[model samples]
Target: EALDGGPLARLHDGDLVRVDAVAGTLDVLTPGVLERPNVRPDLVANGYGTGRELFAIFRDHVGAAEAGATPFF
Candidate 1:
């Protein structure tokens, strides 16, 4: 009874995925999911702009000062 005509009916809740296309919508794979959530640091260090940007964004926005300073990256 999925309304969107997707393959959700065929999928389990925790399935891994890479969406190749969606009808009448932008075609892009899922960027990051549970099985893979981050670019490796070595890969980032090897001149990937997107990875570097992601790293910088994470470093700048993660964590609060009062919670004992847990590192997010």
Candidate 2:
């Protein structure tokens, strides 16, 4: 699972999860299996490309992709 550190902060690596797309919800089968987020520094984008700076505003302000990718604040 992609650990974004948003709502599923308590989920761990081996924890079982059930996803119900029809109901639009996720159920954690095993509780108390929280794991610390493993954020890799090498995976972080540094915005060092031609014309890449132009979209920096959109990258920083855009809302969730599942929410239509709209700008916010």
Candidate 3:
């Protein structure tokens, strides 16, 4: 699975993370050794142009980021 903000925050720039695709798991070798990367969380909430309202439906209906964020129920 994709390691989002929480797990990513615990890893350093050079740290290694092992992902066992077969087992569907990940292990962070060195955690909390480096700072998290800067992100624009506010921008996500601000919406984009006039299409923002139109796209809200898709956004709300979409699945997880790693799961293609599709509008498939």
Candidate 4:
């Protein structure tokens, strides 16, 4: 999963979430979800390494994944 600059980073365990791609919306159903403490991820290691070089500019393009992490057909 990705925890970039988005709501997914703030969400915690047991929190309710709703996503409607058609309507283009993402909502947190759990009460006081935002009131909880912010969860900051360790982004230092992501700057380089971790097999990221595989996606270098010379590599073939990789298709995008859908909501369920399914690759485009």
The candidate maximizing lDDT is: 2
The Cα error of candidate 2 at residue 39, in Å, is: 11
> Worst ten-residue run, lDDT, model 3?
1-10
Question: Could you give me the TM-score of model 1 versus the true structure?
Answer: 0.19
TM-score of each: 0.19, 0.42, 0.39, 0.47
C-alpha lDDT score of every prediction, in listed order: 0.42, 0.65, 0.63, 0.61
Pairs in clash, predicted candidate 1:
none
RMSD of 4: 7.2
| lDDT for position 11 in model 1 | 44
Candidates 2 and 4 compared by lDDT, better number? 2
Question: Backbone clashes per model, in order?
Answer: 0, 0, 0, 0
Candidate that beats the other on lDDT, 1 or 2, i.e. the better one = 2
User: Model 4: how far is 11 from its true place, Å?
Assistant: 0.3
Better of 1 and 3 by lDDT: 3
For candidate 2, write residues 1-73 as lDDT tens digits. Answer: 2335454655657889999999988888785544445553343566658888887888667776578768763
Could you give the candidate ranking by lDDT, starting with the highest? 2, 3, 4, 1
**lDDT, candidate 3, 4-48, per-residue tens:** 455554554678888999998878777544455644243465566
User: 22-47, model 1: which lDDT tens digit per residue?
Assistant: 55343224433323423323334544
Minimal lDDT window, size 10, model 2: 34-43
**Candidate 4 colliding pairs:** none
Candidate 2: deviation at residue 6, Å?
A: 3.4
Q: What lDDT, from 0 to 1, does candidate 1 have? A: 0.42
The TM-score measured for candidate 4 stands at 0.47
